[model samples]
Target: MKQLNKILLFTVLLGTIYACSTKKDTVISRNYHALTSHFNILFNGEEAFKKGIEGINQGYKDDWFQQLPIEPIVFDDRKIVAPTFKNNSLGAGFGSKKEKTTTTQPAGPFEKAEEKAVKAIQKHGMNINGLERNRKIDDAYLLLGKARYYSQRFVPAVEAFNYVIANYPNANLIAETKIWRAKANIRMDNEEFAIETMKLLLVVTDTLEADLPNDIKEQANTALAMAYVKSDSLQKAKKHLILATRTQENKAQAARNMFVLGQMYANENKKDSAAAVFNKLANFKKAPYKYKIHANIELAKNVVNDSISSSVLSRLEKLIKDRDNRPYLDQLYYQVASLHEKNDSIALAVDYYNRSLRAKNGGDKQKSFTYENLGNLYFKNSEYQFASSYYDSVLNVSTDSLALRIRRVKRKYKNLASLINFENVVATNDSIIRIASLPKNEQESYFKNYIENLKKQDEEAAQLRLNQIAFGANSSSLQTNSKGEWYFYNSQVVSFGKTEFQKIWGKRKLEDNWRWSANASINTRNTDSVNVSKINTRYDLASYLETIPTDKQKIDTLKIDRNQALYELGLIYKEQFKNENLAIRRLERVLSLNPKAELVLPINWHLYQIYNKNGNLEKSNTHKNVILSEYPNTVFAQIIKNPENKIENKEVVNEVEKTYKKLYYLYKKGEFKNVLVNVNDVLPTINNSKLKPKFELLKAYAIGKYLDKETYQRALEFVAINYGSTEEGKKAKEILKQLTKE
Candidate 1:
């Protein structure tokens, strides 16, 4: 009986192995492969794909300040290469600090999913007589294409999708596969082909014998919308977005489409249409919390008017006060500030902008806008110090200097820097003159009070440091030792001692008797018990009084500097800023201070231009006569004599300098495309200008950034050969040598 049972088990095992052979086209073989791919391999692949999508959604931050793209994931233009799955044990580079610590970057979820999809196809796929018998193999190909798409490898993704469409034409997922292929084409910058393919797919689906599912139709519409957006065809994009929203298959996606549609309408100034769309989206219950909140904000902005302003304000305020909307407070506060600004309540708007910045978590782009708004307010009010500080903050937070908004801020900051320097020089000179004119007693009293305030601030800072040291002492992990060793051995205690020493003795050189300030000059009188009176010269009153200009020649020099600063300030305000009132004030002050002979003519010319622009003919003629009669042979007089020759020789020089300055700034900001375009246009016009060599060199640098290395080399050679005598040409020659070595 035992022998018979063993033989029966051996026969059953052999039969099972033969029945499941993949080379055969039997029903058992096909079902076995399909079940293995579907129930096991494909299931795991789809889960990893879902996780990858979630990762992308979590990592990407939407820039609410600009028009949002249809797809949330954006491939970095500078990082378009295929992602590597290998571990970076070498770190950033050899001998770098990062190389000291080994880091391993695991394979991303998309890569794992791709690996699983490949496994499913290679191990379980059944191909007989050039026909795919495994029904689940098409799904595996679709999964492979999706994995590549999310990895930003568009060419590979397109090929995978094409394989399924070409070989598995009658697959159940054929329509979705085609849609993914169209999306990949759009990503590859082939928007025209994507648009045509999407349109054809829609037409074919509509004419099919079977009714197309609404979800499939929704995807097609979404793909077409993304294609149109890529091509900058907003009108066509609006139609597809509207269709996508109406389908409502994916609630979150539909909500996004509706909001984008409203933004498009708002951009085109169709407020009623925009308000309708936003109002519906704002009330969408199934949408994500962020989308719903932002939708409400958009609705309030579009529909707010004199009659409904109060209502809009009430709604925004209500949202802000809600505890559930805490995470969205930054955006809510910013919208409220914009509303107040539109109503001309600038003070209230400023308060709300500050409140927005105080939110626990605010986006960098949002903070930049707030800082820029405050800077503009101060600039309009002629508060140059405040404006300059706020503009500096904007630049610090906004790292993308290539953005148009950042470029504008950078230019304003550069111009403001010159004005600030002039203002500082004038202020310093005026302060010195005023102190010198005062009585000796008054000067002594003023220095004493300043010293007292400085000492008080220092004492408060020292006390704060002591409090921090006490806290550290209680929490320190090190065991305490005897006093002889404790002060030097404990790091925190030693740090505190160094701070105290520096505070009292200031920074001193390591030498014998370093405490004595007069050691180098008076080396013989160095006894410690010789009644040494150590007066810290930094805080001494005599040090302040001795620096004041008391000599007539020195006083005159201060006045001259003050007058020069006022003259330049007048010109900057008049020519660059167009502040006629400020210009007249500053220029007139220069005259009162008795400016030099060379400054007299230029100041008068600027005063004449400003007053004449303001229609004050009486004031204009008074200064104009000074230039015309006193400096008759000057270019200013020549220009006034013949108004038709408005483009004076100096004007040509100024134009070239100004154009070069703008191009240089654009190059610094990495706007190479615009720099190249403007350089090409201006080079043809300024063929005779002395600054022509500078423009040629700038064009070469732009080519290096915006085009290929070979093109850059050719451009540099042109500059080196044509204008070799100029400084720019010499610099270009050096760069060409470096390129050759590379």
Candidate 2:
């Protein structure tokens, strides 16, 4: 009787399960599907969606250098979409090759959430007579839309959102879905449509009607603000952004919205409005740490004036000293540098710029901007070499979007390159000429002193290496060294080592392979028969003297090259750089060198212009009279005679470039002699042309291939000095260095 009762109970349970059919519109079927969809499938789907959003928040980095975007999503073409549920032509368990491939591949959080949503819709959706009885079906569609939106598939995401709105118009989350739809529209760059739709959504869900929840109202306002921002309507954006912040469910987004709104006001020069916005954001307790920090920075920027400069600087300095603000040290340092620069405290500005560069964990864009500022500061101070280095660093890290700024920097760097090259030439040639002119005794004394210095440097370097080795071998020694215990701290041990070293080596040179017996040249076969005492040639005065130029012709050539560099540098300073003092200095040195007839008139004309610009008419007339008297028929004289008369050498410049290209082609084809002949002929005709550098460098390359090493070096040296800042000139300098090594 008990076994019969158990069988009857099992039969009734099976019947009850079978009776809950999805095709039937009974209360049992509807409740079963709704509960399963909501509690099981939709619950997991929502959790996965939240996880995906968390991942995105963790990874997304806002570019603070530019206007921040509304959304934090940055999409890539990495995800492959899987087949949808509606395509049921294939069996429920079967799929095509493409679908199978998609299934086998690992999916990201968004894709996993999307998969769960699709599963809920396909399995639990109770479409009885074309009406979804499962209440959670609308939620599943909303989830699907959100996943697609974040995945950057805006069109498909819109389709999913439209389905939710069309199928379930009275759904509790309809207002939220519309806001998502508008956001997707903004992302697609249809800001006009997004703006209109968002406005309509606001009207439909008006607070006066009591239809919209506070969170939904905030989402709608945020969407509308983003739409306006995208359309370049910052004023309209500010109103909505303000409204959005008042009822914000997401404190982080609200903080960012406020910050962007403040930036817009600052951009428009509405400092008071911007200050009010930033002040509030800075004091917001629930705001993200980054937004709050930047808020304080923006607030300080707004109040930067003569009276408040001290206070502002103190505030930034306090932030810098705080350990919690370590990650933002680069930006803080940059701001301090900018403030010092504005106040004309140039030395402090330079110090702060360097500090910014050395700060840890800085963004590349921040570093680029800092480098550019430092470069500009040095450029203004006439420190071309330092400026060139900083500008080069900026180019290395700066984004390609800054096309105009990059172009301007390149132009300045090119001009500075020339100055650097000529400066190097003057220093090098001056040293050589001065040393070559000294008497033999004085020259010998100079080399002996130089050798002594060289010995000291080498010995110090060798000792440093030895100390490093000793420290590495003994851990205790490293610890002691770190504590300021020098390797020579024990005077007795140091004296013993020094005495022992001198006894065995007899003041041997510290160099590579120094300990080898072969270097000592002692005969191991007959040690007693050979003399142990021998001089190292590197330490001998004659060895150093032999390297100096004794030939008058070579020395003369160097003087000519140095003079030409001075002439070019003068023109660059006066014309390109507009530095009157440097121009005067360089041109005066050229005249003192007794420059060639060809260079004399040009150098004088440049000095005349510089002095004239400086209101030193007496000095200006001196050069003006010289140019008119010495080269009356020249272009310089013509220009001086009539200020309106321009030197239109466009055709000549074009012809010079064409000639250089032909010569370069011949050079590449191994026609070295032809290249040399053409370059020499063309160079004389275009002596004052900017394209002269190209022909000169080509001539050097041809000489390198066809002439002796000494002549090749002389040709290269000429190019290096005459066109130091040019691309061709830099190549010549590089080649010269390699030749010296060889």
Candidate 3:
């Protein structure tokens, strides 16, 4: 009886509201979609789109791009210190480090779109449902689908689009809904399905209104083209790309389109057409990629090399020298350098190489390569010292590239050994002079000052050593989260606690060095030492009796510290930065300080290695032979046996470096896309070498030159390991670290 009464009441209400509802439906359908779809201002994803694009642009670099783009900011987690690039700015970008409550925060475009769609749906959800219910409510569903699509909720977006399609068969927006649905399918890797549906969109062809928007058609075609490209359907890709080009209207956008098409054609060896499109793009000053200036430079090169026409040179100069284009000066300088090299103007080339180096900033990987080329040039000119110097620069920045480094070192070793021999002879002859020149008081004073300096250095060294150990161990735990930066987070609290702990207790570590002693240790510390060797008449002068017995102990401690310092110096000089002379000095100092048994042979081999440079060939071979006879089975001797044998192991890396060099060369030639692949290949093995930081830092710098922040951050992290201790490394670690966080 209740069900019957409800049905009777519902029929009465439906009849009562039918006339009013009919009038409303007609009004709703006529205006909103036909004029202002959704009847409200669209959030449009326009701001985000522009911001993302601008952010990328601000970050977008090719070879010479020099601008600070948006940096990644870590929210909390004080222990995680970020890296910086240059000393130009520090702590300017990241958020505070108060134990980072927001690691994976809710952000990104699609999320906003999805949220807005949901809010809109909630505001007007469902209306009438029967035959009389207006079908135009499907637009909200389309909005939902688009919102989800923007938010990257592809499946849900697809569902919303599907809802509009299935529920509103003859609705005005059926075409728009289908296009959105197809795009979602493309993202899901349902390319074939998307292509099929896009073709279905053709079935609605009548008026332009009856069909999808030209922009929608263009997007659909592009989606299909990319699908073809991804599937390796070159012909289809070209066909679709051409289709897109014809319809693309925005001049800058169209230029971007043409540039990409040209790049694809160039990739496929269709040079003439590629040249044509490049020419077309170069001619268009209105294009937004003016900073790139790539097409202009390349086309000019093609023209200049073919015939050194004044017009081509003028065009090239405009691209190179324009103030707006100065950010890409690395490429410009390199191009000019190449032209000088091509003209057999070696000195001019060297000058240009230096200019290129200066112009490179940190963002150009090709600049490290400038060292190699310049080194080669000097070597060819038989300016061995100059070559060695250039090689040293190359090695310092080119870690992991053993073949090139070894070769340069071999050359430099010859020169260094000759100098060492000269030093040895000079030292032997000058011994008498040194002794005769110094009076007793002066000698004593000299020794005393030397000892004091050594002591100070030792203390500083010990502290640094402790710092390294702390960094490698439980330092993370002691760290507290502060605000904004992860590194600063809770650091004050940690600092306070560390201070309090040190105050209450004495310094107690099993390890030997402990200069960062507690207050108690300081209070109970021994007074000034007395030298028993210099004592006078005994009148309770026992205060001066402490030194004679402890001399051996001090020597042992100094010896140990010196050796450790040598090992660090060796790694730093050899693997970290390739400052061979500094490496050699540190290693030799270890021997002079009489390091233990384990260190002697390695030091000797390294000395031999260092001596093998250009001017010291005889000495290098002498050391090599000495190592061969003495430490035949050691790693150093193994390298000495046949430098040629390592060539194959060097090949993958050789190819990797070669890729960068080639890209740099192409970059010099204004071939940006080729440089892209080179960056990709070399990017994978940036950390593979002892020179990884140098290479990786360069790579990140290169990527930062032409690409986006996200990619630049990625490359910088791999480099951070190599640079953590260095000033550049420190900067790189902080900068790249932040980027990684972002």
TM-score of each: 0.73, 0.74, 0.43
The sequence of per-residue lDDT tens digits that candidate 3 reaches over residues 1-742 is 9999999999877754543333345554334332332444234433443444455446644332211111111112333222332221101122222223333533765444444444434333334343324343465566667655654556667767876777677887777788778777766667788777776665446344365667766666666666665566767876766776676655554555566666676766676776677787777767767523777655533433444434555665666666777766776676666666776888777887888788735333566567778877876664445766776776567545656545655556454444344334434434433533566566556555655575478557655654554453345545434453332245654455455444433344555553222211322324675422322122112322322223456545544654655554554555444567666766666667667765566567666766876468876777678678976765456657756322223446666566556656766676655565666565444534544454445555667768877666545543443344445566775675466466
RMSD of each: 13.6, 9.3, 22.1
Clash count, one per candidate: 0, 2, 54
| Ranking of all predicted structures according to TM-score, beginning with the best and ending with the worst | 2, 1, 3
Model 2 misplacement above 4 A: 1-20, 23-29, 76-106, 266-275, 297-304, 397-403, 458-540, 628-742
| Candidate 2 lDDT over residue span 43-123, tens digit each | 888888899889888888887766677667665545533435445421222233235334543277787777777777777
lDDT of each: 0.81, 0.78, 0.56
lDDT of 3: 0.56
For residues 1-742, could you state the per-residue lDDT of candidate 1 as single tens digits?
A: 9999999999988767865676788888888889988889999999999999999889988766567888888886554454333233211111222234334442898987887787787677677878889899899889998998888877778777887888898898998999999998988888899899888888866686466688888888999999999899999999999988877999878888888899999999898898889888878889988888988788767874766666777889999999999888888898898888888999999999999889978887788888998899889998887999999999999978799989999989988998999999999999998988999999999898998888678668876776666556656653263243334556667677578857775666678966454532322356664554456886777788888777999999999999978987886787578788888999999987789875687678778887888899998999999988897875567668986422223338788999999999999999999999999778766756888899889999999997989878767866764554357866987897798899
Query: Lowest summed lDDT over 10 consecutive residues: which window, candidate 2?
Result: 89-98
- Model 2 reaches what TM-score against the true structure? 0.74
Clashing pairs in 2: 417-725, 418-725
Candidate 3 TM-score, true structure as reference: 0.43
